[model samples]
Target chain A: MAINKLKRHIIIFVMFVTLMPTGTAIADFAVIVNKDNPVVSMGKSDVKNIFLGKKTFWPDGSGIDVYLQRAGKAHRSFVLEILRKSPQQLSMYWKQALFSGTGIPPNQLQDDQSVIKAVADNAGAIGYIAPEHIDTTVKALELK
Target chain B: MKLSRGIFCTFLFVLISLQETPTCLAFQIGNHLSLNGYLSQGYIESSGNNFFGDSLDGSFEINEFALTTNYIANNQLRLGLQLLSRDLGEEGNNEILIDWAVADYHWQDWLGLRLGKVKLPIGLYNQGRDTDFLRPMVFLPQSIYDENKRSLLVAATGGSIYGNFFLGNGGYLDYQAYYGKVDFREDSGQAQGIRYLVSNISRMKNLGSVSDFDSENRYVCGGSLLYSPPLDALRFGVSYFTGKTDFDFRVGGRKGEASGTNKDFIVLSVEYAQPDWKIAFEYSEFTGDRKALGIDIPDGRSQGAYVQLCYHLYDELVLSALYDIFYADKNDHSGSKYADQGQPDYLGWRKDFGLGIRWNITNQLIFKAEHHWVDGASLQLPIFNPQGVEEHWNYFVLKTSFNF
Candidate 1:
């Protein structure tokens, strides 16, 4: 009877391990803005506008500084989950804006840590990072 | 002497640029100045007929180089300029010239202004056509973005106003409205095509032929509107432009004029994007009236379209396929009228099946190869091919580019 009990426990543990590994690969991103930014909550549309250079200033009339990761896992997730654009699509969009002399792409940093630091240093800066990396230097915006 | 000078200047420029840090990131020199540039060369070979400089014997006459600069004068204003040198077959001749120069002012997202030479925002890809690193294929679809009419459609000298309206929920409407004038050179491929038509008209009517001909365009005006819904990856657009052109021809030592041929066009576009794939389609109709010439001319209504699909084979490699169609006259899809005139039926239209592969060798270098199986002779320039025309032909192209 004890041997049967041990076998059942082992089977349950194996099932748990197998199921956990199959969880969705899509990741959620935390949109981070400078702590001093007056805006409290942001919708996905607003985020898109800010990054695409449609919105140039914050509510207080201060110039908004946008930073982004060059291209990687975090960049992909942010574009997919927040901006709803693939990397290729976003590249095309930025190319049009650049060549047309209408707008400039956001400054690209090396990694999430650099993005966080950039936002923390500037009063009007905004960016995104993985959720676990969010800290006190920046405030994770509440998605509407 | 001129070729050697050009080669020397290009070498010096590249040498200087290489000494600086090479990165795709915007290169800033001061508080306001930023720079970007690229260089590309291509080789072409065809199974029949001549294209882009003696392709019947295989040609290496296609190349492009450009340097662009942008200056932020203040938070409200910016200045930009680009100098470009390009050659294709016997055209361009590798002459460096100002491609565009503009001063822009931003008042708000709802309103902004641009003055000077501004690139026309035509169709989906015209404004960004010069950038080699941005496209999946070395050449864009010829149906809508024909190589012969490139300069005529690229940019104009004047002013424009642009804006965007936010509709909420990731939806928005964007637009640009402009008025300007475009220039056409006498030696351009467009001029060759026009000459062919005029000579044919003279032969059929038994009237004097046109020679030493040229054209001038004026009072161009147009606008484009794009709408994006809340959907993840779909956008739609419609654009139209119209202008007046005067064609001057010399006959028997006397100058004759075809005044005010009103030219107009409309294009509709749709694109869908995914993580690893994209699909796009565009349809265009162009019309012109040459009744001012006081002679019978083929109805000047043309239509063209293309459907394209691209798939990412890997992070650095992509494969694309396209099916494009062009009709010289919308009313004569079968070319029967042209056939009645003793010309091949295929001369009235072009249908092309194309496949291409592009590999980004590194951040700064790229290689591309493409092939086309074409079923018509519509785009062929008779002046370049004294040997005659072919109803069916095939061509292959290889290109490499470096960007900094």
Candidate 2:
């Protein structure tokens, strides 16, 4: 009888912890471009190739450029969680592209606000920032 | 539908908030090691002229197929390797070799050491930048950074120390210093257990050691400082170096020994970089007789610089171009010039132009093509081809690269 009561108590405790509502959830975002971009959506793999300089130009040959914020912890984390790569890994990729004459480094902007503004104004521009920072001037497309 | 919209809004809020939160150090020592590698290929076809011995203003060929790999044992230690191949004019002619090997140790956030073979810290791109997958041009300015000549032992077989310091405004600073020798000899690629040494004056060899290398031993040091400022989008870096590349020099007949200087030249560099575009600029000149064969030929000056630009057109394409110039302030010569009356004859100034495109088929695959025009290459060897004209034979190059 004593053993049965202990087991029952353990089960109830486990249930309570497992079911508790912590109110925290993993975050996700829709990577967007200006509404004018022909691209509707892309997946993580597509984004990786685009940023890595593996893909040099756009499909239509209009040419593409970019604006990226300086490297930061939050930015790094978002890139890791969303794009699944560490900063060093990403740096190496850029290093290869930059030295090979395959592509140029992105344009650096002060913050998401500026990045959004620049990208929105230029049809050939692309960038990533917080979803909340998105304005009507630009559009956010979902990463497939 | 209403409920879905609310969920989406909450998601957006969380994403924005995450960008403002503080995070801990991501670099740490753990046994769950991670290994990374890069593969690249390049091809060139120039309507202009460049090549060793002859310049063919209109010859095009496949240039290189290469791959590199990095192995990180933990947050504190790392290893790297590179293999490259170039197919000459026909099926049987090929150039191949090991480009780098490094074993690094992290002592702290501000300092660390690397043992074994590694790149000598010279400029922003001399050692840090070189690879078909990384650069925005089909070729780095030949006038400024290409060292196919005696910069031969580009990567050394020695030790190096480096460090990084973080600054606010989303910026950071870094520096590196190195010491040691190189693997030099008739068959360096396969030779071993050889020691080399170089003396200061022309014929006063026998001063130190000479085993695997021709003859050399000297201290080396270099450093770089970078600022990103509050303008997050803009990053600027300046770098410098003073040291010996190789100490071994087999002097000709009499006074037959050579010694390289412990300190020879200095390099000044600046690099502006962004995700989609970056430009590298540098100037290198001699000092303290940093030389090999003859008593460290002091005061011979050489300087060069290049500006590169690249733009990604879309998902699978990129367009690029670069302009580079290298010449002696005292005289103009081609890539190869003999010593004349106390001065390096004339390794004329050179200008390079290029364009390219790349396509990524998948995470592990890519395809790229590029072209270059070489002009006034008076000092550069191997790549510089000579015709009657000072701007002689220029060749075109085309290559495809693959890695697993």
Candidate 3:
């Protein structure tokens, strides 16, 4: 009888863990720009173009400086959700562009903090980080 | 022994490079200067015919190395250059060459210009063939990226204009157009292949003392168009090229030229992708007219196609399978008619089925192995397979690469 009761408890525990909501587990990431930039909101297509080097300059005539976090879950999420590309596909596209002399990839940083710092220091810089890390030096753009 | 020594040196260089703990793959001297490079070494062996080296006995004379630099002058301008060195059996022979040098200007998302020696925007894989770390397989499908005629299709010295247009509803069109001339050298494998084809045609026509056949490029111009819809991961493209060449033939110590030889080709490609699996297919056709050495050959049409599938086994490992076919003459799938004219029938077409596996040792290091079972000899270079080719053969390849 005791063994039967223990098995029932184990099954309930496994079900509870498996049925939990994923939103609470995964952290929300946000697109960020320098505090001085006038960009208010951006569509997903606009973000894709900017990150892929298709849009070089902002509306105000300053160059758009792009930054990226080195390969990680956040990087993968940003590529899939915003850029609409798989990580491997993104890497392959960059390699082709680099070798063919068509364009260059964005500057890559090691972590979110580094990306935030770089974007904060540059006037027209843009990058992405976890939502909780947003501070006064950078403005988080709303995804449309 | 000489080949083994070369392999040793290549491995030693890779080992030494790995020991250095660099801050980044690219060197940043200032705000605008950045440098990148890559190196790869490969070994091939075959059961009957030779490819890229004395592969029948196994050799290591296949390698590729390149260095690239980029300068960002301003928001609208960028300049870049790449120098390449490569060897493939008796082909490239470790020759240092300029791969590409271009000045690119982007006025907007819809318009851009590239001027200088630029890579030919052919099928999807031509521009990245030498970059081993970019793909999961050691060699691309030979039917589309034909190794025998690389110089004829790889790059051009001239100018190009490209752009992307949004079609609304998540649809887009990407287009590229180029005008230029390709460079051909006497020592190139394409030249040797052309020489062999000319000699065979002359002999068949009973022309006397035909020798010293040389080829020169006149001009080439083409464009590629690709469409992508809002669909998950799908793309379709069509590319076309038309060019003219002049060949000089020496018959009985007399020089004669065949001018205005027209060459035209088209390729259609389709690809579907997901995070872990991808499928692709491409079909191409080449048509041209040949006349020289007091003999006239009718307009010849050839076709090649392949279907490839790749699956990621692990996060860093991939497995692939491909079926490739090439027909020297689309109308004559069987070489019986050509054989009746007193030559080998196996030259009519070739069919190959291949399997490959690749492992990413690190983001910067890669290892790959592949095997192929082939039937027919239509694409084999007669110079390399002088001992004659077997109708059916198999080949194996192993390669390693490191890039920064």
Which candidate gets the maximum lDDT versus the true structure? 3
lDDT of 1 by residue, B1-404 (tens): 13443774576376546655465444767647877677888999987667667998998888777776788886668898877777888887777767788898987777889999888877887777766667778778888877877766778899899988988665888898889997777767666666666666666666676777988876678888888888867889888877776677875456766644436788899988777788989999887565324664555688999999999898578899999999988999998887998878887899989999988786667899999988887764456776777878888999998765
Q: Which regions of candidate 3 deviate over 4 angstroms?
A: A1-27, A84-86, B1-19, B22-25, B201-214, B258-262
lDDT of 3 at B299: 39
Name the top TM-score candidate: 3
Mind sharing the TM-score for model 1?
A: 0.89
TM-score of chain A of 1: 0.78
A75-119: candidate 1 lDDT, tens digit per residue: 888887667677656765775566556665667788889999999
- Winner of 2 and 3 under TM-score: 3
Best first by lDDT, ranked: 3, 1, 2
Candidate 3 lDDT at B373 equals: 94
Question: Model 1, A78: alpha-carbon shift in Å?
Answer: 1.5
Q: How many residue pairs collide in each prediction?
A: 2, 105, 0
Model 2: fnat (fraction of native contacts): 0.09
